[model samples]
Target: MITMQYRIVLPADYDMAIIRKRIAERGHLTDDFPRLAFKAYLYADRTAAYAKDRENLYAPFYLWRDTEGMNAFLGGAGFAGVIDSFGRPVVNTWSVWHAQVATDLSIATYATREIAPIAHHIALGELRDTEHARVQEDVERGALAAVTAFDPTHWTLLRFRLWRNVVEVADKNIDVYQVGHISQPSAKHDS
Candidate 1:
């Protein structure tokens, strides 16, 4: 599977209601999209007390069944619409090692993402195993969904999770976003 995200940082004075309305209107277009696992429509409000900094943005995260699905979405009008609205964005993708979502994912209203560098000399097998285990532990601790993946180009590991409430992480680099909606074609899965 693959994980993808594109973050579009808006102006400090940008109104987030525009993003919320867009999601309310168009987020469901991909509800039954082929080969899609889920799409987390996420955004951050700079004015919110929970915000790490004063930077408003609309960043959507996606989990695809394969490259074919990823390519199809990128080439489709849905992506074109994004380009028209926000201009082109630097889309980031990672090869997923693990992904799992609870049966009742609708209650997930918040999401978190952490990106950490992978050591060049580290044992990849061991690293993958360790990250996979961590994801399992997070699920057991009440995460509604979790994904562990890595980008070979950047040698960075990405840990993403969905939750029912806002969660604070000790890692200062972690990004927290409010989930506007979730588009899950498969609906439920574990892997």
Candidate 2:
């Protein structure tokens, strides 16, 4: 599967209610969309934890079954609607490994992006296995509702988590989360 993210960082004083309303009104429009695995409508307030140095952001993450699905959305009216509402967005893509979802994710209130900088000397297999293990750990123990890992291959070792709250282990880490509410699918999906 292909993973995609488009982030729009808003000004310091930008009203976040606009974003909330947008998510509420249109977050599920992509449900059952062709070749779409899922979309997480994520946001972090300017004052949220780990957001001290960042602007309020609307960063929606997507998992597409293939590139065709991604292209369809990006090259269609859906993308045009986004541009009209929030200006041009820079899209980022990554080759994903395993994206595991543990039952319903609608209960999530926070999502975390945990990254480890991978050096050129490290084997890709080693890094992949490590992230896979981490996902299994939380998913098996019911600590996380969903987890996805991917590699962009030149920057950072990346993984994402959808949780009901900030896990205590992440309290001291540089973790980002959806400040108030999360817009995830309510139905359970096969992992």
lDDT of each: 0.91, 0.71
- Clashing residue pairs in candidate 2 are none
Model 1, range 26-48, lDDT digits (tens) per residue?
Answer: 99998888898889999999988
Q: For candidate 2, write residues 62-109 as lDDT tens digits.
A: 777789999999998878999998888888777777778645666777
Give the runs in model 2 whose Cα sits over 4 Å from its true position: 49-53, 141-148, 152-155, 168-173, 179-191
Return the lDDT, model 1, position 49. 67
Q: How many Å off is the CA of 187 in candidate 1?
A: 1.9
Residue 168 error for model 2, in Å? 4.5
Whole-model alpha-carbon lDDT for candidate 1 = 0.91
**Can you give the lDDT of residue 9 in candidate 2?**
81
